[model samples]
Target: MPTRDPDGIRRVTDAKALSAMANPFRSRMMDALKVDGPSTASGLAQRTGQAVGSASHHLKVLAEAGLVEEAPDLAKDRRERWWRLVDPGTRWSRAEFADDTAALTAAYAAEALTLQRQFERTQEWNANAASVPEWDAAAFNSQNWMRLTPEELGELSGEIVATLLRWSQRTVPDDGQEREPVFVFARGFPAQP
Candidate 1:
């Protein structure tokens, strides 16, 4: 069995888990929960535009698959149950989806939608970046072409994930401090056209 990684990510080689995550809305809910931390179904519905019942149902599926869990610490009352990601992130190889066509197709579609969401958010930030001087100065948008073997590519990917996880784990004290959530999404793929 593989051990825990520094990036707080659990690589999913199981086709069952992959199929469970195939739904676009489920993926979005997971992303929102990751960003907002522990959140109730109503909160997710407001952020994700899903009905409260629908959010609850999808969260149940994710929870059964060990993707998300209840965070009672953040709940306001007995009736409310907050959800959070079981891990900081999820990753899977192409091989994991190779045997199941439905799972593979769903996985790709979910990834495409995720990238679209990221692009939209980036545009939104770039438009208002000037108003927030700190973020504006620290924000980045860069791309470079690299020629490397598969081993080298994997090594580089691991390094980036570790660094990002370290930064992501840094929390802010809620003592009247100005704070905002930062989304750090990264992708490394072939440069082929």
Candidate 2:
């Protein structure tokens, strides 16, 4: 989830903003803001089960990166400062890496490793469970061959993003659900020679 302005538009788009989100703690803080609404540093710490100092540090980093903004403390608590996501849909691209093939390749490798680790952790948890029906309910990876022009591929990418966003918005059942966080990653490019 992202924090949106009154017009429901994102406001952050730059390398610094993107790098801010690359850190796990800052990213988690953004998630907290999105799911729980505006909060003070202490409130976010409580909600995310993070230490107050750690949360404050990350929040400050996010604020410096323009990913979050300090809001007015209407509660009359002078010591506490409220913060909110600047725009939930904010995105950034590493313009400096636009022509760096090695850097791009490294980024892809890092993402793939992250996905693999997530899968392995889930498998470990499932192995210990007596019945893992919910685990089975999720889909992991998919790849296919498609004959399409570059423009068509771009359209397909947009469609996939929309579908994934819809899925993310779906409500999960709360019947004692012990769900693990799952990551979904999809990458497509020209086939190798």
* Stretches of model 2 off by over 4 angstroms after superposition: 1-13, 46-49, 73-76, 94-135, 138-141, 166-185, 191-193
**Candidate 1 clash figure, as a count:** 0
Worst 10 residues of 1 by lDDT: 1-10
Cα lDDT tens digits, model 1, 1-193, are 3224546578776555666677777888987987777888999988999899999999998888788989999877898798898888787776667887876776776567677888988899988999999888888877878998989999998889778877877766679977777777778878875
Best candidate according to lDDT: 1
Displacement of the residue 3 alpha carbon in candidate 1, Å? 8.1
**After superposing candidate 1, which stretches have Cα over 4 Å from the reference?**
1-7, 72-78, 171-177
Question: What are the per-residue Cα lDDT tens digits for candidate 2 across 87-176?
Answer: 745532234456866554544443454456556756875685446665566545577988889889878976776676666656878899
The Cα local distance difference test for each model comes to 0.80, 0.67
